[model samples]
Target: MSTPEVSGALAPGTHSTGAHSTVTAPPEASTFRRWTSRCGWALAVAVPLWLAVGRLLTDSAGSLTPVYAATLAPTLLVLSLVALAVPARRPSGYPSSRACGILLISWGCGIVLGFTLPDVGEGASSVLGSWAGPGFEGAAAALSNPLGIIMLFMAVLGCVVSVRHSAHGDGSGRPRDTEEDEAQGTGYFPVLDV
Candidate 1:
């Protein structure tokens, strides 16, 4: 007695031996995921160095205050860690939930920082006076100040990039993958079937 042929359903290198067929497991991680993880690590290392350089340039003595390091370093570290933790691929959808959450959090932080932290430059201090208070005026001042303005611009840019990233599954910022491409090529595995 003969069994039914499964047609073109077998994997690229899978060989059918009688009735018991061996199937190959998919890859542990996609190329995109691996790259994203690597990038996260790179960013984790680079951000502190970049911030330190900026601080040195800004200060005449090139000395870092303990308070400045304590506050800013941890905030940046957490943000970078969050970037590392976010998955490379997400379902195709408009205005990704994760992206929106991050944007909101950034906006809140920017506003709070504007209200609390003193302006750095003499020009900024002269223009935007002290706004530390629990009032609507403080919020308005936060939106108008230089730091707040830069933060708003950055948050918007992040939103646009995140939306684009969410639209593509592979996180390549490209169109969807096709089935024909998958079927035609031999993936990472070497073909064992003749």
Candidate 2:
């Protein structure tokens, strides 16, 4: 007697089953995401390098300038972008949550340090204090100056860009697929006898 065949759907151990059961994998991370991630890593790496080089190369007069403090915003922005872009190899809630928390903390620290530090200038501090609140009023008076204004603006812009970029995925803002999966594949239909 002949074995009964499954109908309409694929049967086990059949080539048709294998073909029809195929699954399409998710898409890889987008270029934008990758760029953001790399940018973050670069920023994190560059800051220490700058500090080390500045210490070794610059004299006291040059070292006192606000340039080092001014780099805070850009560094934080890059680090945050990196946290958002780098795809995790394995599923873990902690990594994502920790990353986000660190990003926020870094941004906050950058803004505070950039604004409150003595090198930033009094005039710029005053403006920031007036808008942000009284906590910065004293520093504002100390940091006021044209250069300080420009640096403050740049810092704000960096923060805004980093926050905006971190909210979305690569180009289309879609979630990236796991690296292990096949993002593109064909579907198959099979017929079977009852």
Best by TM-score: 1
Please write out the lDDT profile of model 1 over residues 105-135, one tens digit for every residue.
5445453443333334432221123322334
Q: Note the Cα lDDT for every prediction shown.
A: 0.44, 0.40
RMSD of each: 13.6, 14.4
Candidate 2: list runs displaced more than 4 Å. Answer: 1-17, 47-115, 118-137, 140-194
lDDT of 2: 0.40
lDDT of 1: 0.44
- The TM-score that candidate 1 achieves is 0.34
Off by over 4 Å in 1: 6-10, 13-24, 28-31, 60-65, 78-194
Candidate 2 per-residue lDDT over residues 136-180, each given as its tens digit = 667654643443454345434544444433333322223334431
lDDT, residue 178, candidate 1: 49
